[model samples]
Target: MEEIDKTFREAVADGRIHGAVLIAKDLTGKVDFSRSYGVRSLREEDPEKRPPMVADTPMRVASCSKFLTSIMVLKCVEMGLANLNGGLEKLLPEVAGLKVLTGFDDAGNPIEREPKSPVLLNSGLCYTLTFPLLQQYRKWQGLEIEQGYDNLDQNFKYPLLFDPGTKWAYGPSLDWCSRVIKRASGLSAEEFLQEHIVEPLGIDSDNMTFELQKHPNMQARRGDMTFRGGHTFTAESSSPGTGVLQYRDEEYWHEDIEPHGGQGIYTSPESYAKVLWSILSNDGKLLKPETRELLFKRALTLEAEKSFDEYCEQFKAFVPGVPVPAEIKHSHSLGGMLTLEDCDGDRWRQEGNLSWSGLPNIMWNIDKRAGMCTIWAFHMKPWGDPICIELGTKFEKAAFMMLKQ
Candidate 1:
């Protein structure tokens, strides 16, 4: 444990990361190790003037939000409010009639068409819908460039890339799932989480809130974003794909629309670790044993798994700064990525371990077999930056080694 702590502190000292919070725990809910390093934000003019990072420091967990969203949807399933195999047409009527984006025409306009089959609620959670939604939201807000998408109706009107359940593409499908939860439960996503997950778990409300602006305490503790360029950090926000410089304006922190289920939640490492611990222990207090089992089990079919692998391969080139390891064999579960087999040399996670990462380098994993769950969070941009990858890998290796002792 001491050695793992040393490695993390050294990484911050060496300027590899702005700051990070890590939490590792055993099956009994005892914390095996936990630590925070560096500043909460490098946006300050003087590095020495920055606030110190702490366990309770709030951060946008990015796609890590998917895990919570998935659980809530499953909770609705448990309450008999939803069907896993049901098609979206009945649950989310707006999305049921939507088309998919096929390709671009000679004029560089999107070629859209209808899907051959309906999108199941189960498969919808794993697909990508965020980018198109964002584009549409900007248009609805009256932004001129890239305008025209109005609501869920227009945002999801693109043609399907492939039949749903046949393949997987990462998108805003979970956000739509959140919408379904809202409709079925008669509560907002934030309200449902507060009444169910947050309150029941005894987690601090400020620690895991959907509304950062409403929670002033969390806002004060929010970490600033950084990129890989220098030892010194800047407060500027950059668009995910395009290198366009943008401010972390009102839209960045607060959305007038319903909370995004896929990527909008903000939380701390300690707060989220509690949720993971519950899964590792398989306590029936929240989800039944059978439902918990589904989270770590392989949910993708053989054909879909192959498609996911190819999709990941194409995405690797777009990310700069780090090389994504190709040795890891993975399958998708309802909760996150399930490790199918051990990599040739990489043993960061045991086989059957469920893991996933957020867009800003935040990552977490639950290794039920190993009696451990872990999270690594840093407010950094360009998700696949090599520095973040290397730091995260080092942290995992150190954690497993500590467990062995």
Candidate 2:
């Protein structure tokens, strides 16, 4: 733990990271280590004014929010409110009528046509929308559209990159899934999640809510957002490989949106760890054993798996800072990215581990086989910046060694 702490402090001192929260818990729901390091915001020059990074500091977990969304959707299934294999179009008619984006026209506008088949709920949960589709949605649905269920419904009018079930793409499928959960359960996604998951688990409401209201004690932390330089790192020279790049300043937190099923979560590392523990414990209180298995089991088809692999390769290249072990094969599960094998001879996560991260460099890995779950969180961007990934990897390695001891 000391080494891990030192690594975080060094990164902060060197201006690689602003602050971070790290947590590791073992099989029996016992926390092995939970700590925070660095200042909450580098922008605050006054040491007295800046908040010290603490375990309870709230962070926008970015895509990691998908895990909570998935759990709530699964809970809907457990309660007979929704079906896993049901047609997404049934809940949201916009999904059934989505088109496929073939290419762009002379004016640089998208050209789309009808899809060969309708997308199923199962496929929608795992696949994401293409960039063109998002752009098309903004074009058609109006830029003033808010990011809520209605906005998602309107965005569903955009084209699909591929026939939904034919290939897997990472997009806003879970966001749509959140919409489905809302329709099927007859409750707002946020309310349903609170009633069914957060309150039941005794998790802090402030840590899990979708509302963007600022809290006196739980305000979202600001990221460092600096640029790294080759010879001399300057704010303007910040590249993905270089210094921190701040995306959201303090003002960004004031803007609010409806609970995004895919990425709109604000939580602390300690609060989120409890959700992981529930899965590792397999207590049958939140989900049945069979349902829990669905989370780690390979949920993608052979063709879909191929598509996922290709996308990941491109994704790795796009974000050079994030490291993916070459020996590891990945498949999509209902919960998140599923590891098919131990890439580094089980030096860290075991095979069948469920892992994913948020856009701001927050990461988590649930190694059910090892009865361990670890989370590393910080509010920094561009996602997968090398410094943040290295810190996370170092912490993971240290955690595994501590477990062995």
Candidate 3:
């Protein structure tokens, strides 16, 4: 652990890692150890400069929020507020008649549009909002929109990419799911999540909600040519990558939608570790143990091999089927990108490990096989460059070694 910590610190000192929170848990999913590294800002420093890199500073841990959002939705499922196949129609009356987008033409135009038939509740959980989903979603935002949510209204030609069950193109699915939960539970997504998951787990805003309000400023970072070659920072929120970005600053939190529920979450090593424990433990607080099992299990598709290639070129996710239960097959689980296979063959191959990475390079991996969850976060530019790969792999090996001990 010392060697791992030293290298991680050295990387931060050398401008290799931006900011991170790292944790390694035992087989029971208890985070026996957790550590955070680096400052939220990535600026270079001089001898007289005061630099801060620590666990106290809050951060907007992008896509990692998906698990929390998903869990909150599932809790609704457990409480009988939502059925796996029923939420869409109940949440959005207009969505029942939506035309799923198929593709865009040569000029970047949506090409195919057809009525989405027999949609699954999980599909809406992924970001399939119709006028009803959007209109009812206002409860989550607390503002009545003159119009409903649409990535691009009247862009039916933008197409559905592929039939819902036939492919996995990650987009605004989770946002739509948030709306579904809001409509079904008759509570704003934030309030519902707080009452059911956040408060129960003791998770708080920690200024992340505040930062998002400032949008384009709060949670903003500037790129550079180097430590000395200054770069003009951009003022914008809403990450295009993985659709997991948010535009919020201190002022944004004041708004009803500050938490945004999509990503703007300020998490810590201990807090996030608790979430990993809940999901893996299935302790009956968040979701039933069996429900948690289904989450980690593959939810890809029947023809994932053939269709996924068409949807994405990188990572190339595959459903290898379930290794946990005879009746369960993990082949369809889309919990997290299988960005990692093995840390060096000396460690686990990352199978059955549900996890995600924050833009600042905070990465987590869960090994259901060992009931262990490891998270490492760092603030650095080019978030997922080779530096993260090497360090992330080393971190995984170290965590596994800790469990072995």
lDDT of 1 by residue, 320-389 (tens): 1122254456678889877677532334577787887786778888887677888888777656655666
lDDT of 3 by residue, 19-44 (tens): 55677776554337767665544344
Clashes of 3: 43
Each model's lDDT comes to 0.70, 0.70, 0.51
TM-score of each: 0.84, 0.87, 0.71
Return the top candidate by TM-score: 2
Error of 3 at 160 (Å): 0.9
User: How far in Å is the alpha carbon of 283 misplaced in model 2?
Assistant: 2.3
Highest lDDT: which candidate? Answer: 2
Q: Which model is ahead, 1 or 2, in terms of lDDT?
A: 2
TM-score of 2: 0.87
Position 225, candidate 2: lDDT: 36
